[model samples]
Target: MQYINFLPCEWNNDHGFTQEIFAIAIKNNIGIGNPDTVPYRKSQMKNSYQFLHKYKADINTITIAVQEPDYTYTNPKTSKKFTQAELYDFDKNYIGANIIFWNIQQPQFDSVLKFFANN
Candidate 1:
């Protein structure tokens, strides 16, 4: 199944004007929640893991992934490009924070494993 970011902007061009079209697209495709919305994506991850644990044991894996945006903001009027380093510093703390968050969410990952082990 194809996957798309659940962005309202994309729905207009790809799924038509109405939300019914958007819902149809979601039903047809593998609609991963938007990365920009952390809580929504996190919930999606939990639900997906649970589903995989129940039905797709071979494919289920604990994935603690973090994706920083590829491009920095560019000034449209000035035609100036801002490098990632210039926009935001990538440092140890950034890595540490994600690690901490991943650790905090380990129980959810563990549940998937426990489900598999029991069955």
Candidate 2:
């Protein structure tokens, strides 16, 4: 199955419907955790991990954003250059890394690394 976005059109603070949809998608083998959203909303993040653990989503296929490159990207195919804001938007909407392979920067990722090294 392909990827699915569980973020609802209406963010009315109700997540029950979205949760059900995610369950269905997981049951059908849809890839989870790709294309994380902007601002990385806390609710979405929580739900994604919960479902990922609950459904035992394939660990190898899962992805998460690792870094915030401070540069513009030129599309090789069309030769169209993307502004930094556009790049950030794309990263938030389309790019990701596996939990194990996420190329994140300091602080948050530092904590994760430290925890693993200590334990």
Question: Which candidate number has the best lDDT?
Answer: 2
How many pairs in model 2 have backbone atoms within 3 A of each other, for residues 3 or more apart or on separate chains, i.e. clashes?
3
Q: Which stretches of candidate 2 lie over 4 Å from their true place?
A: 1-6, 10-15, 37-41, 57-60, 69-119
Q: TM-score of predicted model 1?
A: 0.22
Which runs of model 1 end up more than 4 angstroms from their true locations? Answer: 10-104
Q: Lowest lDDT 10-mer window, candidate 1?
A: 91-100
Each prediction's TM-score versus the true structure: 0.22, 0.37
Candidate 2 TM-score versus the reference: 0.37
Residues 1-119 of candidate 1: C-alpha lDDT, one tens digit per residue: 21223434533234443344334544554332222212222343343322322322222121222233223234344455433232222211221112111112443446434543765
Q: Would you list the clashing residue pairs of candidate 2?
A: 63-97, 64-97, 66-103
Output the lDDT of residue 68, model 1.
37
